[model samples]
Target: MKAEISQAEKAENLSMTNWFSLLGLAVAVLLSSLNISIVNVALPRLASSFSVPMSEVQWLVVVYLLAMTCFMPIAGIWGDRFGRKRLFLFGIGLFFCGLIACIVSESLTQLIAARLVQGIGAAIFISLAMTFVSDFIPATKTGTAMGILGTTSAIGTALGPVLGGYLISHFDWHALFYVSVPFCIFALLLLARQLPDNAPVPFKLVKSGRFLAQFSENPALAGSLTANVCVSAIIMSTMVVSPFYFTDGLQLSPAQIGAILSVGPIVSALTGAPAGKLTDHLGSGTVVRVSLWIMLLGCLLISASAFWTSVPVYLFALILVTAGYAMFQAANNTAVMTEVKEGQKGVTSALLHFSRNLGLMAGASVMGWLYLFTSTFFPATQNQPATAFGVTFLISAILVGLAQVMVSLRKGR
Candidate 1:
């Protein structure tokens, strides 16, 4: 009788924790995605405000990811040592500080530094958000949780451009940064209240040290890492190039561009659960490969659009990319969580996020460099079109091809 009563009590407590954690995490994830989307939309305006070329201004995006990537692994490990809740709060606080710094900055240098701080904080909370989901939910339900998270990501992504456009048009570019601050504070307070308050658990360093070592033995980890980096590179490259292309090549307004761009993420956010279920049925390796193929087609379409100067084709291409992203996220996260060992959930989550942020940094930096190089080396081409951008997409397609191969080899143990 006592055993039955204790089990019921434990179950009830876990259920409460799950609801609280999921609610807080969903809000946090949404806010982050929304801010990112708005930032992407406001990039050109930011460049105009600072009187800098897109090349220099793009560093605002690149530096943020670089800082986040650098911080992810360490944040992961530290969250394990200090308590995930504490780490989560710190990430929020740091990000809020960066936001304040950005608003007041008079120079580009100051803004970049502030963005770096923001990225580091973002890395901490984003990494721990996954850990919280994995810790709270059962393995069988992880796909659902990730799907919900992915959906949250999609919602923010979809809404960002439209909302951001409205803000930039009516208010100003600064409004984009301003909107996220209060929401982030509220989410922080709520998250702190909802998350588990247990003391940090200690684990042996030697056992924890094996994350990379063990990574080699797991095909899922290896393939997922490769896929994440490549796929994200393709996505980020499109983000950097497309806005410029839309305004310059296509001559679209921010409002019009946001409307067009919103389609992909809307498609993605809607398809998340279905994709999760498909992954549950078909397996991660299969789903990942298939999604990459779809993304490949999208990449090819966008590259072709640049060469041919086809506006319709470029818009169509975004749909494919969004669909692939939605499917890939739902399946990939589930595969990763399944592969992680008994301990080190936080670390594993960090590593996955590390791979992702690295991709974001690489995508923005490499593509931005290519853009600047084209402008510098082929001054005549600048008058022509997104001439260098076409070449970048072709390179990204090959990287996607390589990622497809990695996941293909992921078979039975």
Candidate 2:
């Protein structure tokens, strides 16, 4: 009875700390997400300032993604080797440092370099944020915690363009970089105060060549990771092409494009809490099954809607797609981390991150190439880009559908 009472007190303290940690991590994830979309609005300004070609200026975004992509897997190991808190603090510090450098950058090269630094920090912070939740929160509450994190990310992605537009109009484009600094500083402070400095648990490093195969030794982990990568690929395929569909094909203005794109993230943010509750009640399996079906349906709807020239129809299609992705992502992430062994949390989380980013990179590169192919081979048709995008979505859907099969085939824990 005395031991039972002690365990209950410990549980209560952990619950409070978990909530605080979630708040801190969400802010960190939000700032990182903000940097991704905010700069899209500022690209033209950046181009004019440096007198660079649009293609050259695009590197500012591309480089950041590539840097993050390359660095993300490494972050997982760092979290496992160092404590999650130490790595978390370091990552946030690096993000702000990079932001500061970006604000003062004079040349395009300098800006790209600084953004790469920011990407490295972002990769570290994001992976650790997920792993940290698994550390502090109980298994049952994982979905809810992830839901909050997902919502914060959605808010950042949605608000980034609107905020960037305002700042670029009244202030120099550089202010966009400076804007995120204070929020990150606060996140770092909160994390330090609230997060426990639990010592790192040691483990043998898994090689990239052996990473997937060794991890696949656990059927559940393999299934979860596979599903995550497939869903991520589908989401990114639509996102990468949507701007062209809106601006070039539909002839919307930049602000209108921002508004249209904003709808998905807005709905995502709104639905996050509910999705969390569902995950908590239904478990990650049910959540993923339902979410994937929604995503699959949305993909088909949007692909068909792309044939039409109506703005409202397109926006509605996008909202459905985004909502599906939002729910799918939160549930999928919760599922992925929970399937791993407790001591393997960092590596498992890292492998999952690596897989997702790897999927995005693969999707973006392959889908972009397909778009270019269509533009060259089918240039006479006005619907060529949509056709190309639809084809990509169909492939993505099939992949995700296969993932569903794997999930169904997966046995008990």
Candidate whose TM-score is highest: 1
The list of candidate 2 runs beyond 4 A from truth reads 1-15, 41-58, 165-172, 204-214, 380-396, 409-413
Per-residue lDDT for 114-184 in model 1, tens only?
88888888888988788888677888778878888888888887888878777877875656678777778
lDDT of 2: 0.73
TM-score of each candidate? 0.90, 0.86
Residue 6 deviation, candidate 1, in Å?
Answer: 12
Best-performing candidate as measured by lDDT: 1
List clash counts for every candidate, in order: 0, 0
Please state the error at residue 2 of candidate 2 in Å. Answer: 17
